[model samples]
Target: MKCSAGRKVFKDFLKCEYSEENILFWLACEDLKRESNPEVVEEKARLIYEDFISILSPKEVSLDSRVREIINNKMVEPTSHTFDEAQLQIYTLMHRDSYPRFVNSQMYRKLAQLPVPNRKGSIA
Candidate 1:
């Protein structure tokens, strides 16, 4: 909680893909690992955290109860694909804008589009 609380106000910057709450939860883990053990963090712990996060695919993220209900769920317009087409479609609305602004805007939901949850703690 040290790292999370330390950057709590700056938490707003860490969330671009989803609700700030849940994204903060995941990003906080990075801070946890780094601050917990800075020496080995870059080698062992970071890779482990990333691999674990990768297991949570976009489809899984889209299906998250919080994501569907809170983020303004609209009909997914059924697609034959196993992946979530709805989330991607909504995310693409600002695909052409500047990287930080468009990606970080509240208008966009990061949980769906970002390929990975990669908020490496700035503890260094």
Candidate 2:
């Protein structure tokens, strides 16, 4: 999640699991937090709701009824932090559930084999 390539690989794995929406929702929440413009925040929040909160969306993420209610209420006054609780729930779900599978995946095995860069900028 810290780097683009790593995120891409994880996203691919999530896609295979048919749960890519989890990461997508997390990324959207991250972007929303960085946004400063009120209009843009509102727009992004609406898009997030439509993409990951709405039951009708194909990319909807798994969320509990309590969290869903919180989100529904927050939509009335959207802010960058509006999805904070939902984001945390999804993040916890990914960390506790998907992360273990990800660590055991072939993709992660290949990634683990790659050489790391040393402080001198040479591969270690």
Q: Model 1, 1-124: lDDT tens per residue?
A: 2455434533454344343433333443344434434444334333322332234533222234444443233212211221233234323432333234534544333433444333683322
lDDT of 1 at 3: 55
Against the correct fold, how does model 1 do in TM-score? 0.20
Instruction: Assess the local accuracy of residue 61 in candidate 2 as a C-alpha lDDT between 0 and 100.
Output: 89
Using all chains and alpha carbons, the TM-scores for the candidates as numbered come to: 0.20, 0.88
TM-score of 2: 0.88
- Alpha-carbon lDDT, every model: 0.35, 0.93
Off by over 4 Å in 2: 114-124
> Which candidate wins on TM-score?
2
Clashing pairs in 2: none
The alpha-carbon deviation from the true structure for residue 14 of candidate 2, after best TM-score superposition, in angstroms, is: 0.5
**lDDT, candidate 2, 1-124, per-residue tens:** 8999989999999999999999999999999999999999999999999999999999998899999999999999899999999999999999999989988776786789855456797765
